[model samples]
Target: MDFGEFVMARTPALLRFAYLLTGDSHLAEDLIQEALVRVHRRWSSIEYQGGPEPYVRKAILNQYLSWRRRRSSAELVLAELPERRDPALGAEQIVERDEMWSLLATLPRAQRAVVVLRYYEDLADQDIALLLDCSPATVRVHAFKALKRLRAALTPTAVAGASHGRA
Candidate 1:
């Protein structure tokens, strides 16, 4: 596919991937825009490398990591009001998802990226490592550490209760 067609097909998934990485819609949009600009400049080289999606994804990941490093000292602000919920879903589910996002946000950028790429993107260790320019072992370590932090933040009892409630 051509560059425009590739972008049209992949933008939604890319945006979702960015959102999962940054946990902020605005940041995700900015990240994608920055990445796409870089990708556009090197579209021919990227296309020659094979499919552009992987290249674009790697660009997005790099952009996010760089942005995080630059903004390390900045404070993150959340909206005062919660987002509107779907009436069909239970309040418990919304709370659980929000709590999960909050916990994810507390993780270091590398750990958070690994977790999101592995779990949300269903990427394997080698793929994640390639994306982050790290060893597979490093990816595993990040995932383990991130999961440990998440577990400590949200107890098993709470997870079980949430699951049970859903059932």
Candidate 2:
């Protein structure tokens, strides 16, 4: 497929991947745009090689993983925003979903990326390791740590304490 066709077919999925990595819709859009710009230059070579999707994905991942250090000390808090309620989801489900996103936001960048790749993207550990340029054991460790943190935060006592303003 040509570059335009490739982008037309893949942009939505790419945006979703970026959104999972970023947890911010605008930031995800920026990442995809930047990644597309970078990939456009090498479109022919990438198409000649295995495929463009992997290259574009890598560019997006690199853009996301590196954006943290490139920016200032200010951080984007994605947890709280004025968004319209989804009519299809019940209040409890919305709360759970918001809580999940907030919890994801708390994780360190690498750990969060690993979690998104392994679970949300449904990638195997080795594939994630390759994408992150780390060993499979390291991927497993990050996944383990992310899960551990999520579990600790979700425990009944922990939730109760948090609700009671007890850190």
Model 2 alpha-carbon drift over 4 Å, by segment: 47-50, 68-86, 156-167
Judging by lDDT against the true structure, name the best candidate.
1
Off by over 4 Å in 1: 47-50, 68-87, 156-167
Residue-pair clashes per candidate, as listed? 0, 0
Per-prediction RMSD in angstroms?
8.3, 6.8
lDDT by residue for model 2 (30-121), tens: 77777787788988776434677777888899888887533334432332332445799989998998899999999998999999998999
In model 2, the Cα lDDT at residue 74 comes to: 40
Residue lDDT tens for model 1, 3-97: 77777777878888889999887777678777887788878765445577888999999999888433333332332222345888888998999
Where does candidate 2 clash, by residue pair?
none
- The lDDT of model 2 is 0.82
Error of 2 at 95 (Å): 0.5
